[model samples]
Each structure stands twice: as C-alpha cells, then as structure tokens.
Target chain A: MIRGLVRTAFFVAFCAVIGPAYAQGPLQLASDVFVEREIAKPDGTKAKLLEEPKTVVPGDQLVFVVRYKNVGTATASNFVVTNPMPRAVRFDGTADGAELVSVDGGKNWGALATLRIAQSNGGDRAATSADVTHLKWNFNQPLSAGAEGKLIFRGVVR
Target chain B: MDNIFAFRRNNRPARNHRLALGTSLSLLLLTVSAPAFAAGTVAGTDIQNIASATFDSPVGPVTIDSNTVVIKVDELLDVTVVTTDPGDVITNPGQTGNVQAFRITNTGNGDEAFSLVANTANGGDDFDPSLQQIIIDSNNNGVYDAGVDVVYVAGSNEPVVAPDQSKTIFVITSTPAGVANGNRANVSLLASAVTGTGTPGTSFAGQGQGGGDAVVGSTGADAQASSFLAVQSASVTLTKSATIADPFGGQRPVPGAIVTYRLVATVSGAGTLNNLAINDPIPAGSTYQAGSLTLQVAASPATTLTDAADADAGNFNGTRIAVSAGNVPAGETRTVTFRVVIQ
Candidate 1:
C-alpha cells in the first residue's frame, strides 16, 4: 500500500511539471515588409544592398520576412505557418525561395495555371491572382530549443 | 512658440536677418582673430598673417600643403509627365505646324536630366501619330518652328530640371500635305531618366549614385506618355448653278428673267463642321425673289426663307443670300436655293 501511494505521488509530480510545459508553446512568428537599399560600406568600394526600408509605394518590390524562434526548453513538433498575402500586394513565390502553396478561399491549392476558378459565365477557367488567398510553409523538422530562423518571400505593392 | 518650425516661420525677416548677421559676425571674429591671438601668445603680443588655415586629419600634419575636402549627400529620384490639355486634339491634312503642349515635372529631391523620346507607334493607341518634331518651348510662347524652339535631343544629355519643377514641351505634328481624308494619328511624348546615361539601353541610375533618375509611374514604362490626336480636316466644296425663267415661263439667263440659283455645299471627313455659314452677294443687275429662298439639309426636310441671324437657317442680308446651317455632319450636303429677278 505504501509503495502504491509513493507511485501515485511520483506520477502526480511528473504530471504537474510536464502538463503545463506541454500546454504552453514557444514557437512565435513575426513578419514585416522591408525595402532593399544599397548601403555604402566603410571600405567604400561601391555599395552593398542592406534591408533598410521606409514607406512603400506602387511598383516598389518589397521583401516580407517571417522570423520564427523556439524560446522553449523542449523541442517543437512539425507545424505549418501561413501568412495571407495582403490583398494590396502580389506574391510571386520567389521572394524567399521557400516552398509555398497557394490557397483559394474555398479549399483549392496548386500552381497558378493548374488551379481552376469559377467564371461568371458558369464555366471554369485557369486560376489567376484572385485565386491566391494565402501562402503556407510546412516545417518538416523538429524545432530545437533556442532555434531561430527566417522565411522570406518577395512581393510588389499593387 | 511651441513648435520649432512655427517659431522660425513666424519670426519676422528683419529679426531673422539680424540673428543671422550676429551669428556670422561672431563666427568670423572667432576664425579671423584665431591666428592673431595665437601669434600674440607665441611672440608676446604682435601681428600675424590674416589668411591661414588649420589642419586636423588622420594623417599627422606637416604644415605644408593646403587642401580642400568636399562632401555630398545623395538625392532622391522622381519624375513625372502629364498633359495640361483636357484632351489633345489636332487636325490632319488640316492645320499644319500646330503645337500640342505638355508639361514634364521633376518630382525628385535632386536635379535630374531627362531623355526625351517622341513615339508615333507607342503602346496603347489605336493608331500612331505621325510625328514631325518635339521641341522645348524655349520662349514659353507655346509655338514651335525651326528657330523658335530647340528640337529634342535624342537619347542624350537633355534638359536638367530641378526638383519640383516643370518644363513646357511643344509636340509638333501635322496632317501631311496630301494625307488622305479621315486619317487620324497619335503622338506620344515620353521622358526617361537620363540622369546617369552612359550606355544606350541602361534602365536608370541607382539611387545615391550621384546621377539622375526617377521611378516611373504605375504604367510599368519608365516614361510617362500622353497621346495627342491628329485628325484630317473635312474637305468642303461648294457648287453653284443658276436657272432663269422668263415671263414666258421658260428657263433663261437674260435680264427681266427670274433666275433660280442653287448653291450646294458638301463636306467630307470624320468630324462634323459646326457654325457653318454661307453668304452669296446678289448678282449685279439682279433683285432677290421675295420668299423664294429655300434651305435643305441632308437628313432633314427643306425650310423656307428667313432673315440674317446666328440661328436663322436661310435669310436675306440686304442684297445677299445667307444660309446659317448650324452643323453639317461629315458625308452630308447642304443646299440653298433662291430666285433673283434680273433688272
């Protein structure tokens, strides 16, 4: 009986420590748009492009950076992060060279041409920019503790 | 008083000038008297050279050579082209040597050089404007001729326009001497950033490169374009014939015979001719036949006589026959018929 009581206490202690930790996650996401500027280095050869940005206007190419970090003590599981391409901007999928899927409001996915959209004339046509609703990246690996990286894609403000 | 800009802006010119003078005088005394004060201290109070410069640099100074350093901050690049016309219009085989004006604005923060291009077959036009020349309105008189305006410099160092400034351009296009009737053309004036043109087809100078450049508007073309119309003028022809009926009730041309005169006006082009007025003086030794004037337009019925006015269709203006046809559309004809009695 005493041994049984001790096992119960140990189990309870384990649950107390691990349950809250499992419930709380540390994978955070931060995204912003930045314009590329050519910055002159102190060496003064020519200049190198650095990410210093201000206001964005029409026809200006912008880089959208998504930074993720695992600030937890344990590793994180496989997950997917999605960012809706702002309707004001157009995404060409080459900005960060990341594997991406295009989504429609109604569950459709694939490339720009293979996807089909409904036409007002009661017919289906190849999907275009209006079909692109969201961009998603599926992380295959386990996120280690203190791991941080960036995912970027390019777009132009419409 | 709370805002720095407001303080400066609200300050009077005299006060600002006095403050600026005081600051300049203090700085001048400090700079000019420095060498004299140094000499007074070195030689126990004496004279000195007024013109001398001090040095401070990474390399230790040998007090030998005088050199100057210069610094420049890179400028922003922006430019735009727009037409002041509510609509660009010209006539073909019509008005020769006409001018269509446009304004090119430099919206950049720095001075810019623009490359001018005149295109007859530019994009987004149903037809191409047969261009003659594009000139800078040097005299600001809004006219273009050989010596009156400087012709456009093709793809080279052109005008250097300052920031937030504009230049007047006169696009010279014409309906050729023998252009076909109803011919229409389009002329597009495009300006590009020649701020740093080295080669022929380079896009533009990068920002802060000490060159000139501007971001093109949303049209995806580096230059702004507005097309002007050149339409062929409607050809107008007038034919007159006279038939005389004597007291014997037959057609004759002699005196004492009633002469019936028919004047036909025909127009040919793509546009309507408005405010068309035709006047014919009564032939000598002839008296107009009262109530005999009749006007007939192509699409409408005929009308009887009236009097001289801006609105009357047919009238007699004291020894003359007048027809005031408001607008005779293209491919239509107007006929005025009246009788005159031979004296």
Candidate 2:
C-alpha cells in the first residue's frame, strides 16, 4: 500500500509539471520600436536604430518603425495596434506613403479616398485631426507562429 | 504474508483517486496565476520605464534696454560792439557788452525732459546783466538777486526733446565807447535733467531742487539726473594775420619724393586760447620731416610740438602742438608754425 501511494504521488507531480508546458507550447509575442537612419546596407547587415534622445529641428520628417513577431506554436490573430503622436509633431499620410485612417481616433480605417470624400472633396487634401497624433496598424489576417511583421509611419516636427 | 497482500489490494483504488485530485488542483492554480503575472509584468516594464524617461528641459536668460547723452558746440558766439560819441563829449567813458549762447540737446536713443539753473562764480569781473539772463552774477557777489537778475530773453528753456533734438539760447550785450578794451569776465552754464525715478513708495523729496525737477513725474522706476556745467571766459580784443613763404626752400615734390612745407596760425580773440592746441594733418600722401616745427609767440614762449617726425602728422596718431599764453594782451597776435613733407 505504501509503494502504491508513493507511485501515485509521483504521477500527480509529473502531470502538474507537464500539463502547463503542453498548454503553453512555443507561443510567444515580442515587439521592438525604434528609429533608424539608413534603410539598406551592402553587407547584408541593416543599420541599427539609435536608442538615445535626439533633437529634431523644425520641419524635420521623422520616421518610426515597429517590428513584431509571433515566435509561438499558435497563430496570432486579429492583431491590433495604436500609437499616440507627440506634441509639436504632425502625421504625414498613410497611402504606402501617407493615408488618413479615421475621424474617431483611428477606430475605423479606410484609404485616403473615403476620408477625402467624407471630410473634404476629392479636390482637398486630407490632414491629421487635432486630437489624433498617433499612428496605428491593425491586421485582419492571422500571423502564423514564427512569422514577423513591421509597421512604419512618418511625422513632421512642427 | 497473506495479511499484507490483502491490505495492498484494498489501497490501490484510493491512491489513484488522490493522484487525480492533486493534478486538478495544480492545473487550476497555474491557470489563475498566469494571466495576472503576464499583465503585471508587461505593464510594469513599459509604463514605469517610459514615465521616468520623459522629463523637463531647462531654460536660460533674458535681456533689457538702456540709453546715454552727449553735448557738442556748433557755432561760437561772436559779439562785436562799436561805440561812437556824437561830439567826443566824455573822456575815458566806459560801456560793456557781450554775446552768449548755449547749445543743449538730446543726442541719445530716447526722449529726455530736463531743466537748467545756472549761477556765475566771482573770479574778477561781473557777468553783464544786460545780456539775456540765462544766468548772471552782476555785483561780483556769489548770490542771485531776483530784482536785479536778468531773465532768459525770449525762448531759452526747452520743455521736451525727442531723440537727436537740439535748442540754442542766445544772449548779447553792448559796451560803451571809449572804455579800455581789456575787460574780462567768466560765465558758467549748468545743465541738469532727471533720468529715472525710484519705486512708488520711495521718497526723493530731500534731493534739492533746480534741474532735478525735470524728472519728477517720469515713468522710470529709479529717478536719476545728470548735472554738467561748462565755463567760458569773455573779453574784448584786436586781431592781426600774416603769411610767411615756405620756411623750407620750395621744391616741387616728385611723385614719390617728400617735400617739407610750413604754415603759421595767429589768434587775436579777446580771451587767449587757454591750453591752445592745433592739429594739422598732412595730405594723404605726405610725411613730416624730423624737427621742423617752431613757436614764435612772445606770450607763449614755452610751447612745444607734441608730434614725432616720420609719423602721418594729420590727426595721425592723435598728435598736435600745445602752447601756453601768459595773459596775451588785446590788439596782439601770436603765431605758431609746423612743417610736414609730402611723400
């Protein structure tokens, strides 16, 4: 009876340890946000972004990029992101170059066309709303585990 | 042995039940703790680090405003009096006259409002009262007598001045004919203006009156006033002039050759020019030869040229000749000459 009890206790402890490991699997999510000077390198190594505080003169265009990866066993689905714009800075656009997202703080997004037709006519250019300083990226498709993605936005210092 | 075997068989089922219960409890604990730990760790790292990183920048200094004043003489007062007796009736009769004027102005960046009160000091002769009464001490005494005091002719006092504004006051007097033309007098013009005022509660009442009243109601928080006085001596005189040929033999200087030339100046004004100094600048392409200057005035026998040869000589290096006239008398002329060579 004592031997049976010992075996039973051992089995219970083993299950406790293995169950969490099995449930968690290889799921992981990591994100890095930074700024870089050059976009390319000849040696196959890209230039790293500077992490120090930088002074940007007026009328300078600043580009920020965020890289995210799903280093997990399961897919990351319905990914959503939001960034707030800093004071004394303005967003440029969003059409691969620039774009207008929405009126309700980027809750709903469409191409610049829909925004222009609704806010201004096709004749007028789209501008960032006063309250909207941040840039956001949302994905409708799932990111397979181990897949990576990046989002970029441009702003001008006033 | 038979009893032990039977006990083992009875406990097996109970052991299995206990194992199942332990596993379920372990799983439940991990499930509850995982979400809490994840949320706390992520938020703690991001929010706290960012909050600390963003801070305040420092600031620097600021600036203010200021002003200044300068006075210059434009034209000297020239007074001439001629007396004629219809029948040459009185012998040794005397009369006095004078010409006086003051050039006061604001040559600074801002407007200045000020006042002037002048008093004549007794040296020897009396300031003539017949002249415009900017100020005068007639009895050779140091006190001002209201009844006998001369008043500023018509428009002597200026109330206000914009930047670079100026005003001139004139006074003139005539002397009786047959009076010896050797009389002399000293005159003084004292000018003062308030610049600023102290704080509202500060008391500036104890500062004596006179020109200080000019800045009484000024907006400046600190009231300040400047007082300056200039003294001039008046006299009667005779004058003469003469020109001597080039002291150094005249030679037409070649394009690059240097030739020395000389010239003299004589003064016959009422008052001998005190601390008389003259500046003669050589033409742009000229140079002064060494030791080519001399003073020939009998009254100013101890005169010297305060310039060195080979120097540019005209306002060049701010050099000139200075002379002292030991009370030159009326109707006499004194002369000084210096030489420079043209390069």
Candidate 3:
C-alpha cells in the first residue's frame, strides 16, 4: 500500500512538470509588416529604410518579416514556415533565394519561373512574380533549442 | 490617433494538403489582376497578414501562428487636364460667346472636389479676350447648353469627382474689338484640388476620405490646359459711280447723253474671296452699248472685253452685265466699266 501511494505521487509530479509545456507548445513566432522608403542622405546619397506603414498607398513597396524561435528543451525537426499572400498586395519577389513560392495558393510549389497559372479559357500561362499567392521556407536540419531566425519577403500594394 | 494595430492569433496548422486544392480554386476566383498603372488600392483599406510556423516535436507536429499585422492605405491627390477640342476656334473681330472645351480628370485614389478657374488675356497672343462664363457639362453630353449645363460660380458648385472620372468644362469668352484678322488669342483653364496643392508628397492630416491622410501626387494636385482662338475676318465691298456727257460735249443728264458707269470691287479682310462675281442691271431709262465692257485688275491697263459670254470674264446676259472675277486675294481691287445711252 505504501508503494502504490508512492507511484501515485510520482505520477502527480510528472503531470505537474509536463502540463505547462504541452499547453504552450515549443515554438514561438512573431511577424511584422513595414513600408520601404527612400530618404536622401546628408552627403548627397540616398538610403533605403523600412518604416511602419502608417500611410500606405497603392503601388507602394512593402516588406514582411516573420521570426520564429524554438523555445523547447529538445531539438525541433522538419521546421517549416508558411505565409499566405494578402489580397491587397502582389508579390514582388524576396531577397531570400531559399524560399519556395506557390502561385496556385499553396496547391503547387516551385520556383516562380517554373509555375503556370490556369486561365479561364482552358489554357495555362507562365506565372509571374505577381501571381504568387503563398511563400514557404523549409529547414531540412533540425532546429536546436533556443534557436531563432527571421524570413523576409517583399510585395507591392495592388 | 490609433497608430498601433492589434494583431490576431491564428491557431491553425500549416500545409493542410487536404484543404489546399479547394482553397486554391476559390482563391483563384478572387485573384483579379490589377493594372500596374492604376490609381491603386482604395484609401482606408486594411491590409492584414499572418504567418504560421510548424515543426516536429516529441508530441508530434505542431503549428503556431504569429500575430496579424495591418496597414491602412492613404489617399493620393492627383489631377489631369486636357483640351478636347479639334483645333483652334475660329473667330471674327468683336465676336462674343465663343466656347472652348476642356476635360479635367481626377487621377487620385479618393473622391475629391476641385476648384475651377479660367484665365484669358495670356501673353504672346495678338489680342486679349474677356471671360464671359464657365460652364460644366452637368449632363455629360460633351455639348454646352444654356439651361442644362451648370454655370460654375467661384466656390459654389465645385464638382466632387470620383477617381479616374472626368468632368468636361466649357470656357466661354468674348473676342476683343478692333483685333486684327489672323491674330491668335490664348485662354487657359486651371483645375486645382479643393483640399490643397503643393509639392509632391505634401500631406494633409485628417483631410482625406474616411478620415485618412491625403498626400499630393506627381501632378501636384493642380493642372492647367490652354485653348487657342484664331481670328478670321473676311468680306467684300463694292462702289459704283457714273459720268454723263451730253451730245454737245457738255456733262448733263439729257435724253441723248452717253453715261459711263464704273463699278469698283474690293476684297477686304485676311482671307481670299472665292467665286466673286458682280452684277449690274441696266436702268430703265438707258440702253447698253454692245461690246462696251472694260475690265481692269490692280494697276494694269484696262482691256476691253466682249459683252458676250465667250473667252472673257464678262458677259451681258439679257439685261445685266456680269463679271466672274474668280478668286480675289485679300486687299485687292477690280474695276469694270461700261457705257450706256440715256433715253
């Protein structure tokens, strides 16, 4: 009877230790959207700056940054980040060359040059950068504990 | 005052293959391609974005969504003006109520009102015309009507136009008196945004539609176009005089007196007169002498022409003498002389 009581206490201690971890998950994420601006520098040169888009208009270039961190104790494997394109903007390519873009709303994934969009007339045409509807980055290696990084892409307001 | 945008937390997993096909098909219907040179997204539109990350853990694969970020679009103020008339309007000296057509287009991304101004008496023209009234094409028929079209008063009926919409304006002016023919007159119409105009990127806070900020575009929110008025005055004048000689070499109006009648035709104005012909009917108490028609042009000697319609520019058809002077240049004179015996 004493051993049975000891087992119950041990099970209660395990539940208490693992309960918060399961609820909060192991990965933390944050996202930010900014508008790109060009300002003339003091020495007759121009510099590009990413500023909060308080007064964004159509045809303005935008930068989107997504940050992810592995907060759990163990390493995380097959880490993938996905971002859906907003309806009010058109994809203008990304500085990160490792991104896989989906022009058909994540149904098909490939480079922008290798995709085609289906037309209403039963014919398909090559997809341009503006036709991208989703962006993704897949890390083949496992993410170590407490590892953090950011991914960036650009778009133009439609 | 609300500069901070609240983010939304999305708890859905990433890369749901089962829903990808259906979601893409529906999204394709909403993906209408917008022109690259368009006025852009509507002002005050909220553009939201949310990203998700997935990874394999001891508790299996898990997905976590980042907070949504939003950006609100602002208003862009721009305008364009163009003259739609074919060419310069032709006018005569002291002409009034001439109409010049112009089109004003709002190329910005918000609904805006514009103030209209018409300026006459621009330099480099031969004369200055006076402004009569400014009319707007209220019916959008492109033609000006006295009662149907709206006469624009200074601040009273400014047109609130939508983006990419155009308003036709008619500037009425009166040509100045004593203006020379072939003279040119220039008139201009300027349309400026009622909100304001300045250098590009000038901002007006809380003045845009939906209480958003308004920024001036490349056109500076103001545009002007000019219309030309060309004076074309043309006419012809004629004078006739008679010299009477009696049978005894005395100048008297007697029954047997010979009357020499001379007709002077002068072409005036800045344009040539075509098909110019003068007709003089024989009086009731006179008899025309056969082969008595004489024709003279400018400073050359007079050449006697046959009174028949043969090989000459003169003909005596039945009762009157006709001279087909053809085309006479401006500021030129022609003379026709003939003799008659009084009854």
Candidate 4:
C-alpha cells in the first residue's frame, strides 16, 4: 500500500487523473535505490548490507535496482531496458558487463572504452565513467507469461 | 583561465534561464559544465532516477517507465583552516598587537557556523607569545584593523559561512619581555562547526538546516593551522672614555698635556654589521698628536695609523680621527685609542 502511494505520487498530474491505463498494461516496471552499510558481527568480521537510503551524502555509493514483470497471458519478446543517469551521480558499473552505455544523451552507444566525447575545440577525449549518461540492456530471449527479473547498477553521488 | 572564461560564457544564459524556471533545471544544466566535484551535491538535493523498459508484444511494440525514486542528500559537516601570513611574522621583544593571518573555509555542502580559538602554548618553540584577541574580517578585505574588524566571540558572533566559502581572520598576540633575538614562537588557530563534531559518518538527527540528518565529514568538522612569530633585532653598542696626563708630572688639565681617548665597539644579535666605521671629532681646545691613532681587535696588537689619509684602515683628518672596521660579526668587539694634547 505504501509502495502504491509512492507510485501515485510519482506519476504526472495528467497520468494520475487518467489512472488504471498503465495498471492493466502487460509489462510492469518498478525501480528503487539503496545504500550499502557494513555491519560488524561479534565474530570479528564484517558483512555488506543493503537498505533503503534515508540520508544520502556525497561520495556515498548507491545501488539502483529495476524489477520488471510480464503480467499478461501472452509472451513478450525483444525486451530492452534503459536507465538515464542522474545529473548529480557518477556511473560506477553494472552487476554484469552485458549492458551498453551512452555518453552523449543516447546519441551513440558502445562499450565504455570505445566511446569518445567530442570537445568544442574540434578535439575529442576518451569517455570516462563519469561521462556515462545512459545505460541499456538488451535481452535476446523472449519473456514468457508471468516472467520477472531485476537489473542492478551502482553509482557514486558527486 | 581560458577554460573558466569559456565555461562562464557558455553557462551564464542557461543559468539565468534556470533562475526563472527552477532549481531542478539549474541542476540539469550544471552537468554540462565540468570540474564541479569539489563541494559535491548540495544538502537536501533530491536525486531522482527513472528507468524504462520496452518489449514487442504479440500485437505491437510497447514501452513502460518505472516509478521514480528520490533520495534526499544530507548535510556533511566539514571545515579547513590555513595560515595566510607569508612565512613567519617578524616581531620584536616586548612587541604588542602582533597579528597572524589565517583563513577558515567551510568545505561541506551546507551552510554552517564555526567557533574559533587560538592557542599559543604549543610545544617545539623557544617561547610562547601571549594571545590577545581573535578578529573576523568585517569588510571582506584580507586585512586586520583595530576597530574596523569585529572581535570574534565564542557564542555571540560565531562565523557563518556558505559551502566552499572562506573567511579571513586574524589571531592577535604579543611577545613576552626578555625574549632573545632570533627566538621563535608559534600560535595555532582552531575552527570547529558550531553544530557539532565527531568521527566521520557520525550523524545527528534533525540538526541540519533542511530538517534532515547532519553527518560528520572527513575533517570531523574541525581544522587547525599554525603561524609563527620570530624575533628580529640587530644592534651595535659603543662606549668611550678619556684619561689625561699633564706635562708637569700630574694628572691635570694643562697646556701640553697628553689626553688619551679609548672607544670600545661591540656587535650583538643575529645579523652582521657591514663596513662599521667609527669617527671621533677632536676637542675644540685640543690638537691631535701625529701618528697617535691606534686600532686593536680582540687580542690583536695595537697598530698605529698616520695623520695623513693614506693606505691604512685608520685616518686622521684636520678635525677628527676615523677608523674603518668592516664586517663585524655578532658577539665580536673592537677598540680604538687616540692621543690628543691639551692646548
């Protein structure tokens, strides 16, 4: 119920007025961000724990998780997910190396090392992790009915 | 310099437009400019993220956007203090109102107040200077004025600074009496956030300006810097005495009496005296004796100089006797004696 309220609050006013259109859609998408905490145990060891971020600060690492599910009876094919980086966050990396990145607002997409940013002085520089503006993953296999999966990425607050 | 100019030129119009629109647009435009990672994202900033997914359905292609997620940035308390005075401040013994300049910067991403203190009793120095007052620069001029600058009071006038902004201040002190020349004293100034200070990552609930949590930064919300005061004094001391011998076999002032004058000169302190020459005028009622001028260095034999201005280091003109003793180092002394008969 709390998640439903937060989703309603996130939607635009026009979309909120015309609700239930996307609620009945075949594919449902949900996104959440978290901060990793290191918990120390009595055995003299530490474990990495993820929790809902409450007080985020600069230099703190964040985990972005996107869950997608197909609710319709029919199968979905050519699945592709795209996430734009926030202005105040620098892209770290994804859980897997299967994703492609765009440094120029999705104008071009390639492996991070193969990308270059064109400068106003008629020169170009190698694109760094900070230059990543968009992330995308393509799934070749078709999604069966009621199939669900999640994509994870990390970033640092600038 | 070129990059800064071009960056300002490219962003000024966008910045003005953002001012009319809102802060979210301004933040979006800020990403276009480079080299802004120093102060990081501002406190209370809402970092928003949204994801979209598309898949070909059995009928047609479809696209969907995930629910937006926002994480509000919290306040980070940090500070840095640095001395602005070039080298150590040169001072003298018993000097008062000596000032050591320092700059305090709020290196955090939120507005903060800082309380300042100066300590002079730090070790590894010859002596401790007495601390007087701490003054804040009231006019933003990087200088200290007695009445113009505001005196910093612990609670009443703690300095309030914005993110990445610095405040210049002065730590006033006085050197104690009997401090030897070339002696050094050090003074340190410490500035801490008025809200609180602790280890990094320590958080205080509801103490931040935006009603969020405040966390300590890498500096622990406190910083300190030291400035030095060095005493510099170079001086020379000279004393003269005269004795008379009468031609009538008595120590009396008489005609044809031989009057002998002795002058002792000494150099003291950390510096050397270059080309130190002493000249003594003859008495009004006396006449100088020929070849009577003598120059004697510490244990050296006395050497007489001629009356004429010749190749010797000493010379006697018609009215005075002059001795040229060059390069007198510290703790060294010289003596000159001459004879003049009473008229």
Q: Of the candidates shown, which would achieve the greatest lDDT relative to the real structure? A: 4
Every model's TM-score: 0.38, 0.23, 0.74, 0.73
What residue runs in model 3 are displaced by over 4 Å at the alpha carbon? A1-25, B1-37, B237-343
Go through the candidates in order and give each one's C-alpha lDDT.
Answer: 0.55, 0.35, 0.80, 0.82
TM-score of candidate 1 chain B vs. the reference: 0.48
Candidates' RMSD to native = 23.1, 32.9, 10.1, 10.8
Model 4's alpha-carbon lDDT is: 0.82
| Model 2: fraction of the reference interface contacts it also forms | 0.00
Candidate 4 off by > 4 Å: A1-24, A38-46, B1-37, B139-141, B145-147, B235-259, B270-343
lDDT of 3 by residue, B1-343 (tens): 0121222133222211111112122234345443344677777665667776677878666655566666666788999999988999988779899999999999998888999999897889888899999999999999988889999998999988888889999999999888887899889999999998999889898787766788888999999999999997767899999999999899999999999999999988866778889889999899998889998887789889888899899989869999988888878888999999999
Model 1 interface CAPRI class: incorrect
Ranking by DockQ: 4, 3, 2, 1
What is the C-alpha DockQ of each candidate?
Answer: 0.01, 0.02, 0.31, 0.39
Candidate 2 B-chain TM-score = 0.26
List, residue by residue over A1-158, the lDDT tens digit for candidate 4.
54334333444442657664442367877766777678899999997766567677888888888778999899999999988888778999988878999998877899999999999999999999999988999999999999988888999998
lDDT of 1 at A53: 33
Tens digits of per-residue lDDT, candidate 4, B1-343, equal 1332344345432210111212133235335543264888877766777777778877567666776676667889999999999998987779899999999999998899999999999999999999899999988899998899999988999989988999998999999988988899989999999889999888987686576678999999999999999987656799999998998888898999999999989888855677889899999999999889999876689888877788888998889999998888778888899999999
Worst 10 residues of 2 chain A by lDDT: A22-31
lDDT of 2 at B313: 26
Give fnat (model 1). 0.00
